[model samples]
Target: MKLVWTQIKNFRSIKDSGKIYFNPNLTILAGKNESGKSNILKALECFSLDKFNKDTDFPIDYIEEEYPEVIVHYQLEEDIVIDLCDTLKINKENAHKISGVTVTRTSEFLESIEVDIFKDTLEYVIDAVGEAIKVINRELKRTFKLDINSKSSYLLSDLIEKIDSYLLTIKEFFNEEQSNKLNSIIEEVVSHLEMLNGFSDYISDKKFKATIPNFIYFSSFEDIIPDSISSNEEITPIVNRFFKVVNQNPKLLFDESNPQRRRLLSDKISAGISGDFMDYYSQDSVSLKINLDGDDLNFFVYGTDTQKPFQPRQRSQGLQWFLSFYLTLQAEMKTGSVLLIDEPGLYLHASAQEDLLGMLNNLSDKSPIVISTHSHWLMDPNRLERIRLVLKVNDQTQVENKIHKGADAYTMKPIFSAIGLGLNNDISTFGERLILVEGYSDYYYLEAMRYYFQEILGIKIKKFKIYPCLGSAQIINVLTLLVDSETEYFILLDNDKAGRQTEKKLKAECGIDENKILFTPVKSKNTSVIEDMFSQKDFSEIILDSLDTNKFDKVLVSKKFNERMHNNEITILSDETVSNFKEILDVVATPKFSHREN
Candidate 1:
């Protein structure tokens, strides 16, 4: 199941958050220091599989008077729904009626949080038992002028007792075969009664909890791994995670008397952590060593160049936080978990913080990540559509629907990828990996489409460094600067008159490979330009006239289109429009077509 949206009311600082939509992969809650960004994330966390405290969770003013509620909606994936139906014995045909579900975890029911599932898949099984009861009652009335009223007799045992006594009175009215047939009908009804009670017990125990993905919250990494822990000492959460990652019995490793046995376990643990931890921490080629000499298991890190082991605390604070966070994520998470990460990359420097964002993107591919951060370095300007600006109005939390500022982190450095020299670039170097669009308007459309590919569609795509060359003739001008670049090039243009004329010039002037050109496809295959790649109705409304092309307004249409794309208003687009962009991206992603060296 995919988490779609959430609404919180009277939770801490938030009085009401009006249906905040979540991106399929990632959603960032961004704001200033005390603007309640973390509080908003905490409200999401209170969709508790555990208990919720009213005093701590409810708003300060409305603590005793009001109850807080956090309601989340999920889109049921077909495969997951099928698996659930198989487990619970629900009809697959009836399951089709429910494609989405709303779950409300609220304090309204009691002091503790209560979970209510709307239009659950188990409804099919529940309703089947109800229909069976009505059918049996109808047959009884037709044959014996009797009706089984469950409301009058609440217990299944009571109903069974009443039927048993009544059957004795009617036994003389029928022959042996007729009496057996009557008993058989009642027996089938009894089976249904048992099944209904069993289902009720299943619901009371919250057995359907497997179908709903639980949120795993990690607030921060305040402590690093301990230098030494005793063999019999109570294991803290951090130490517990460390042993789990290594798949080692910490007590056995510490208590071993044989030096050789201790060395074997220690070496295996050191090598395992070094391989996994090196993937995220890039500052140094550091290796972890676990010492099992005495009752205490000690930890240390040493650079590969210099084998002198140093305590974990001796390393940079940022590296320590990175390892702590990574281990917690690996230990606490399961296959279908949703992550709630708060203010990651707080201690890291600028360059390392950027790398942390890349790691988060990789994690988002597997599970839905709702991360909160005020830091700009963690922001991706192309993914501006994913940002929900969190702030406080009249002492209550208010999350803005639109991103007006767009990557509030770039205020100091004046560095945002969307400023035209996109992705990672300065003024002089316009990034090595190039994707040249036709004009500024084409650039905006492609950038918005990249977010859709990554977050909504879950497509693995290159972090494209798109730069518009203004026109087809200007493609070579951008190519000249990236003559000896490392990555692939993508030249996007319309399938029209000027585009055909300019294609030949690209090969002659830039010495570009024919395979590098990724043309935007149009469905109609008429005299179509890049704009015609969209729906015919949308194109006529947003760009050209409904019938006549003479009333075209490029500047006005481009401005309106850009605004709508940022606000995520243009998402109700035709599948053909999305397919056109996907085809172009498919070519761009293909690395088998090698780049020509200048």
Candidate 2:
């Protein structure tokens, strides 16, 4: 089953968060602090757990009047219907009727109803009535001139009326038994029709909480281990469950005669944790030691070089968090649990966060993971469909699946930062000059050249920031936000059709001076992009080093420039390319060039 969408209303800061759809594997709820991202996750938790306290969980603004409600819409896999049928004790006919359902929650009750329960029965009645009409038409061909040969030829309402009217007229011609059968058929059809029409009355919530999938919420790993060895009271529910799974009997740890059993159990659990840690951290031979001393469970880790084991708390926060999280999930999570993680990599470095992303992706194959995060590194830019932007509008929280084009710069700042442009007002003003590039590759190439020029020639260029616009079209949007009175802006566009159109819009539509729009110097070809500014030999060598030789193409070179730059292996540029770069820098750095039309 998949949580396809959710509708939140009057919940916390959210007055009405219009229906928000979710991605199948991963759904990222992204927003700034206090923008109600956590509130949305809590609402989902309440929906899954079916527990809502009016005084605590209810929206404070509306708590006096009435508690708010949460509605969750789900799309179940076909096989899950079989399980539902078995659990509900519904017969095959009714079981087939039990399609996907919607769950709604209020302070008083949690309700569930089948989305299309009456569809099959209604279809059956329609087909049966049409067949009867066909029989009547054939039998009374000369007597009546009704053209009800095919059900598809007429609407359901018109067909029903025609059949009813014809049946009444023919009642006198038939005997008592025949008249009764005809009446029963019409009555059955009408009854089914009534049931189909009265869908709202037929559905009600049941007490089958077992049918709802479990929601496991993990915010932190601090409580994964017990504080002392006195008792297991401080251990988290997930940890307790993990121990139960790892050890068939909890008392086995205290069995003095069965020391081998204790060692085997400890070794097994330790191996599992160690394997996962090694896989994610890419460390060589890290081992774990799980010791049950008295009523306490102690966790320790040993690196390859360490002679003694280190307590989990003594290690780095990221390592401890990752180990505890991975082990808990590996031991506790069942097949169909919906995992809700809030800020999963809060303490991890960028590289480890990336590893966490890979781990999350792997876990998603078993269960859907919905994570709330402010870290751009946590988001996969390649999967924009998995992102939902949360923003506060007029003091009401709104969750948007797609970022609105008209959203102001502040509203768009998170997404901009996720794509790697420092667009905050303070950072935007750090440089006296701004060089707008079409994409990240352009930014990287220019910055790399700027450094090269400074190093090779000792000519200190003016301090400028290269702002990548994501694309030529986005340039207009970025300009709308970043353009101010003090800053001098220059747009470097390719000499392609899109670049030309963008240039036209910048000048005519945006009132930007034509001189501010810079294009790649004309090479041999009329169509030249930023890549054409670099020498072919050096550019091809960089591409070859970054990607496979067979995949070396102009498109890939332009697209994967950021990845190549991050690799830090290709820093060489041809002398001609360096000269061309110097000339462009000289042109942009001129005092007269900075003062030309705002």
- Measured against the true structure, the TM-scores of the candidates, in listed sequence, are 0.63, 0.60
User: C-alpha displacement of 127 in model 1, angstroms?
Assistant: 14
List model 1 lDDT by residue over 1-598, tens digit each.
7777888888888899878878667788877777777876777777755345766887788856467887787766787566545645667886664556666667755221121221231233234334434444564553443454432312333444555555454555556765565665555545544444443444345545555657877767554677778877898787888887778777667768999988988898888988877787787788888887577788887887556988878988887788777777666554467888889878899788877887777777677888888676777655555667786678887876555433344331222333334334343334445578787567657776665566556567765566667688878766665666564677887788788777888877667788887676756575566676777776766434323456555533553455355545555567877777777776765542223333
- Model 1 misses residue 293 by how many Å? 3.2
**1-598: candidate 2 lDDT, tens digit per residue:** 7676788877777788989876667778887777888888888888777787666677777755456678877765666666555544446576545665666776664354435454455466656566556656566674345454432334334444665665565555567775565776767766765554444333332333444545677776344553234344554565665565465455555453466766777778777666656776753356667776656667777888757888867777877777667765555345467777877878888778888888887777667788888777776543444678888788778987654333456656655664435465444332567778887557656766665555434466776766777799998987776556467778899889999999889988899988888888776898887777878887667645536767554433543453334324446668868766665677676642232232
Candidate 1 at 418: error in angstroms? 6.8
Candidate 2 stretches with Cα past 4 Å from truth are 63-66, 82-99, 119-186, 189-211, 227-235, 244-249, 255-257, 283-285, 331-333, 404-411, 424-500, 503-598
Worst 10 residues of 2 by lDDT: 200-209
Off by over 4 Å in 1: 63-65, 75-80, 83-90, 108-199, 205-207, 334-336, 404-445, 448-532, 535-598
